[model samples]
Target: MTVPPDDPAIRAQGLVRSFGPVQAVRGVSLEVRRGEIFGLVGPDGAGKTTIMRMLAGVLRPDAGEIDLGGIDVVAEPERARAELSYMPQRFGLYEDLTVGENIFFYGELFRVPHAQRRARSGQLLEAAGLAPFRRRLAGQLSGGMKQKLGLVCALIHTPRVLLLDEPTTGVDPVSRREFWAILYDLRDSGVTILLSTAYMDEAERCSRLALLHAGLVRTCDTPSGLKRAMAGALVAVVAGDPRAVHAALAGAPGVLGRLLMGDRVHVRVDDSDRRVPELRALLAGRGIADAAFTAIEPGIEDVFVALLGPEEAA
Candidate 1:
């Protein structure tokens, strides 16, 4: 159950993809270790899907080398694809096919033997909690159920590496949690998973994360390491007018940064230990009272805002 030392599961160096005049991915290099979950996180049109497609051997990169499980993906796509499974944002599931039928179809396409396909389909159906609904048409399933069915199809042949593009989007909270549970089980069983996600919480679950912004890798590290690299301390400010507080504190002395999170304003300071008193007085001077403030640790979202800064350019 060991991946060869020479095989990285997925390795790309200087990867670049462009659409005519627009460059989607620029000089992106990534390596996913065996039996680990790696996350690529960013906003819409951030080139995450482009990279995933290239690794899956669906879309060719304009420049760079892609290797999958010791096979050159660009040179030998067929061989590379044989060892990988890709679940795109919109999975290809036959609406008229039953849950069991769809799984069997994918297994057959992957060239799984008849005996193995039967056993594998049963195990996958049970694992996805779709065994009881095996006879139901895929179109009749709920959004979450459909997503689970898609995952089961992708994993029917037990691929060495799994590439998922926003697999949990539009899923309910409970189902998202369950989906992650299943993913953890797969990782524990020696699958290398590289997934793209918009949810900050989901990104935090990965062993390591790469932040992609404007077609570049802004930073890549473990979640804890990224947070620790943040230079300022985070302070949450609860005010009657959070917007006003945000504006008032934008360039105020001692303020390094600020983020608007729902109803609270997260302010970053040059020094968390000393900024509280000054912040309070500054608000008081502006006739803003009853402001509740607390020093809190920075999360992934906070780090993103700090790095990206305010949306409007200076």
Candidate 2:
């Protein structure tokens, strides 16, 4: 199946899935444009993994329509998979196989011609800074290096779309930055990417994001757009004890939501102009003095917390 160049690289609508009585996804829909990075952002058990699996054709959806490029993923999984590469949270990287061996193995599995596989491997290894470590055993590589190798293996066949599930979960900050740099390069080269991540920073980096909560999509928009759609103003409260500050503001009038971030508590209120002073007085009445309040710009996580509500935020 060949879609027009302007068509979405990946599309799904009314996606519904369940594991016995527990439904993991409900009416989830998404359209990823060509050459852009789309993100699925949510907490654990938000059905990120299940959605990725269904989109990858690794798991059959109980009810849904999935189109990969021009191929119907549900009706023709094999053909659709030819244009898709999915790297789940736990990618299958053979521990004993050397870096180069694993790449060759996946290339063979994809049936890439010998000449093409060799050339592709060299380019990917060098681009990922693994050219010098091609002979190292997969088990001997560091966590970050192992992830890069997994990405290299996934890209060995040059699929048009890539699905990554929390690829940077445990990687160090510096390595995570490097990994994203490679992804940027891929996107620039016209490979559409759909990835799920728990990190707000990563979510901010995506071209657009779908915020999932309890088997449903709360919202979908660009990072800045989502922040702009935030209903109220966010006020950062810094006090001696963060938890105590949160408790003091619980159910306070005009307060929409509150989230504790490190030493500060971000309180969403109906109006920052009026609530800031009122909140200060209330805190002082509770014998909490020296609390400083500042209105701050809402972040992606703030929007998520507000949408998820206090119960789901927990």
Candidate 3:
């Protein structure tokens, strides 16, 4: 079911949270539509986790309003929590218990009836690829399998909203793909998912994304929309000495900035058509005559790097 345009499944206005002297989440506002995959993308220490915790009712917000399905999360946490499921970065699971046992425990805790738990657990195990491993101890499972089990436990009651904080951090590429496939299936089945991710490719899969930096949202929009909003043209320059190339083009006219991507440097310029030849000439003048340059379309990663600035320096 599509979300009502006026009614968001999850809504936050002026959300703020602090940890001792650190303002972890600062005046953040967001709205998540029903059945939509909304991604919170940022690096570590960007307060993504803090925001998720507050929304999940695990931590109280210092200030602001949190509404989940029209229930005020901050004012009525238990009621709000009844409609939400949270899978933290390090979701706790009883490692010694069998997969079936783990699911049963979580379902019971959520107050699912015995008969309903039996039926729901079976479906969740199959969906998470844990049906065959039902008899296996959770501790004996692989890293990916363990994560899948955690997800099944978190979803046993079939919550309307799913909050995942960096769920696929260290999983293999294949497992990550499978996990996302399951998430998309859940979304299609009318479950609103709010996930935080460090992976840019994963963020691209979301219907919408919020880019956070230094406890503030830098931008929020569809992935394509954000890419289209990049302020400068991206030109890829291949040079023998990328450092030297960057140094030479650092202060060149029309050049906004440059980033080194392995063997090549991505130069952001105000006018690519006017700057390419000038950049090539500048590199040649620096005795790096073999440098080749070509203007290319800016991507989400390019925009992210540009907005967040250089990681080492920033």
Candidate 4:
């Protein structure tokens, strides 16, 4: 399960793609190290799926260079695709097929040997906790279980790279955690995973992640790195009138971003020590003298809004 030195599992440079006058991806570039879980995080319509499809060789980019496992994904897709397994948002599993049959079908399609398929299917089922449901039909399974079967089918051939697009959306929190555990296990076994997710919490679990928005990468780094890169301090203001507090501070100097959470309003500013006095004065002017304030740690959502402003993250 050891990874090769100095060789990235996947690399894309200056990728650009457009569809019917709408630009989906705009000069996006990224690299995924061997045996690391790299996350592409963004809200919907952020071009995460488009970039993934290009890397998976399912779609051609209008312009870019892509390489996977040392093979040029754009120039030699067939050879590059041999070392990858991609499970998109909606996997095409036959409703009538049992879990065992579904795995068998995928194994056959991949040209896996009968003995190897049998062994692999058994191992995957046991590892995924699906050994008891081998006889159950695919459509009858829960959303999380269906996702597990898809992963099993994808892993049956033992590819070097795994590409997943928004894998945990709509899944229950418990299932999402379980799926992430499985991903970590695969990473420990030397499988490089590149998955896209809209959830900021899930993005924090990756070894490194790129934040994409409006077809561009706003930032790319480890969760801590991204948090540290935020150019401000977060102040939580507990007030009886959060809406008024937010409105009052919305256009204040040095204010980066603001969020209203129940009775509290979190504001990001360039310098809380320098501005809290002025902020207090402003609140007092507005007849808001009872508000309590405390500096707080910045979350991913805060960083995004601080970097892109509230209009963009929304």
Local distance difference test scores for all models: 0.87, 0.92, 0.88, 0.89
Q: Which scores better on TM-score, 2 or 3?
A: 2
User: For this target, which candidate reaches the highest lDDT against the unseen true structure?
Assistant: 2
Clashing residue pairs in candidate 4, if any?
Answer: none
Q: Quick one: best TM-score, which candidate?
A: 2
Segments in model 4 whose C-alpha atoms lie over 4 Å from true places: 1-4
lDDT of 3 by residue, 105-182 (tens): 989889988898889888878888889999999999988888888889888888999999999988998888889888
Q: What tens digits encode model 2's per-residue C-alpha lDDT throughout 1-314? A: 55688888888999999999999998899999999999999999999999999999999999999998778899988997768899989857998999999999999989999999999899999888999999999999988888899999999999999999999988999889989999999999999999999999899999999999888888999999999999999999999998999999999999999999999999999999999999999999999998999989988989988988767855
Candidate 1, residue 307: Cα displacement in angstroms equals 1.6
Give per-residue CA lDDT, model 4, range 1-314, as digits (tens): 24457678888999999998999999999989999999998888999999999999989999999978678899888886659999998866887999999999989888889999999899889888899999999999998898988999999999989999988888899988888989999999999999999897888899999999989887899888999999889999988899999999978988878987688988988899998988988998999998888999887777777778777777
Between candidates 1 and 2, the one scoring higher on lDDT is 2
TM-score of each: 0.96, 0.97, 0.94, 0.93
Report the Cα lDDT for residue 140, model 4.
95
Worst 10 residues of 4 by lDDT: 1-10
Scanning candidate 1 in windows of ten residues, the lowest lDDT window is 305-314
lDDT of 1 by residue, 1-314 (tens): 35576567788999999999999998899988888899998887888999989999999989999977668899888987668999999857999999888987888899998898889778877888888999999999988899999989998898989999999999999888888988999999999999998888898999999988877778889999999998889999998889888888978888878988878999989887788988899899998887899989888888877788757211
> Of the pair 2 and 3, which is ahead by lDDT?
2
Report how far off residue 9 is in candidate 1 (Å): 1.9
